[model samples]
Target: MSIDAIIMGIAFICIHLFANDLLPSGRIQRLKWFSFSGGLAVSYVFVYVLPTLHKEQITVKKYSDYLTMESELYFVGLIGLLIFYGIQKVVRKAQKEGENKKARTLFWMQILFFGLYNALVSYTVISHEVLGIQAVFYGLAVGMHFTAVAHDLWREYEDIYNRVGRYVLAAGILMGWIFGVNVSLPPVTETIIFAFISGAMILNVLKYELPPDEEAHFPTFAIGVISYTSITMSLKFFFQW
Candidate 1:
C-alpha cells in the first residue's frame, strides 16, 4: 500500500476513535456538521463513484461475452442499501425493547454489522488505489460520516458502545486494510464492492446525518453540497476522468 493509503487508514481510525469529542455537543452545530459531511459523501458518490462504475461496466461489457449484466453493480448497490436499512431497523427495535436478553443479542448483532461495514470501507480505501487529492476528499468525507455513525451508536447504547463497540469498529478498519494489502479481488468483484459501498454510504448519510429542517442548518448543508460538488465536477472536467 502507498503511504497515502496508510495515512488515510490512520486518519480513519482516529475519526472513529475521537470524532465524538471533536465535534460540538450542541444539536444544531452537530446537525450542521453532519449535513456538511452528508453532502460531501453524497456528492462523491453521485459524481465520481457512480460514474466510475458506469465506465467500468462499459469496459466489462466489451471484453466479456459471457458477462452481460449491465446493471449488476447498481443491483448490488440496492442490496447494500437494503441490508443496512434492515440492520438499522433491528437495532432500533432492540433499543425499544430496553434491557433484556433479546436486546443484548440484537446489540451484539448491530456491532457485528457495523464491523463488517467498516471493514468494507477500509478495504475500498486501500485496495482501490485512491491517491492524492481525490483520496483526501474521499477520506475526509468518510471520516465525517464515521463521526455521525459513532455519535448515533453512542446515543443508542452509551455504555456498551464506549466500552466495546468503538474498538470493534476500529479493529474492522485495520483488518480490512491488512486484507486489502494481501489480497486483491478480480475487477468485477471490485466493482461490486464499490457499488455496495456506494449504496450504503448514500443511505447512511441521508438517513442519519440530515435531520428535520428545524434541526438542520440548510445554509451550511447547501454550502457543503455545492462546494464538494463543484470540486468533484471540476476535477472530472479538467482531468477528464
Candidate 2:
C-alpha cells in the first residue's frame, strides 16, 4: 500500500473513533457503530484499495497518476472533516432541552438541501454540461445531496446524521472524481441545478422572500438578482484566459 492509502485508513479510523465518542450514550445505539464501521470499510475499498490495485495492475503508469489520487484523497478527507464537524455541532445543539423545534427545523432544512444535491448529481451524470458553467451546477447538486441526506437522517435520528453522511458522500465524490473516476459530471453544472431548486424551495418553505420579511408576498427578487450577477461575474473570471 502507498503512503496515501495508509494515511486514508488512519484518517478513517480516527474519524470513526472520534465519532463514536461524540454521540450521546443513550438508546440502543449499536446501529451507529455498525453504520460507521460499514461506511468506513466501504470507503476504504472503493476509494483507496481498489484504485491502488487498478494502477498497480497496469503495465505502464505515470507518477502523476499516483499523485492525482493522493491529492484527491487528501481533499476527500478534508471534506469528510467538514461534514463530520458540522454534524457534530448540530447534534450537540439539538440535544439541548429547549431547542427541540428549532433543531427539527434545521435538521429538515439540511435534508432538503441534500435531496436537491443528490438529485442534481444523478441528473448531471446523465446530462452533460450544456451551458458550460459547471461550478454553479455542481454546487447546487452538492447542496441538494446535503438536503436529501439530512432528510433521511432527520427521519431516523432527528439528529442531523444525514448531514454527516452527505458531507462524506460529497467529499468521496469529489476526491473519487479528482483521481479519474467518472461517477459524476463536472461540479459547476451540478451547482447551477442546485441553485434553481433551492431558490424555489426556500420561498415555499420560508413562506416569504429570502432575508425573511414579515410580508408573505415580499419580493426576494433583489437577492436573486445580486446572486445571479455574482455568479455571472465568477463564471466570466473563471473562463477568461
User: Per-prediction TM-score, please?
Assistant: 0.92, 0.30
Candidate 1 regions off by >4 Å?
A: 62-64, 97-101
lDDT (Cα atoms) of all candidates against the true structure? 0.81, 0.38
Clashes of each: 0, 36
Superposition error at 217 for model 1 (Å): 0.7
Q: How close is candidate 2 to the true structure, as a TM-score?
A: 0.30
For candidate 2, the lDDT comes to 0.38
lDDT of 2 by residue, 117-185 (tens): 334433433343323344443333233223323333544453345346445434443443333224553
TM-score of 1: 0.92
Off by over 4 Å in 2: 1-73, 120-241
Top-scoring candidate (lDDT): 1
Report the Cα lDDT for candidate 1.
0.81
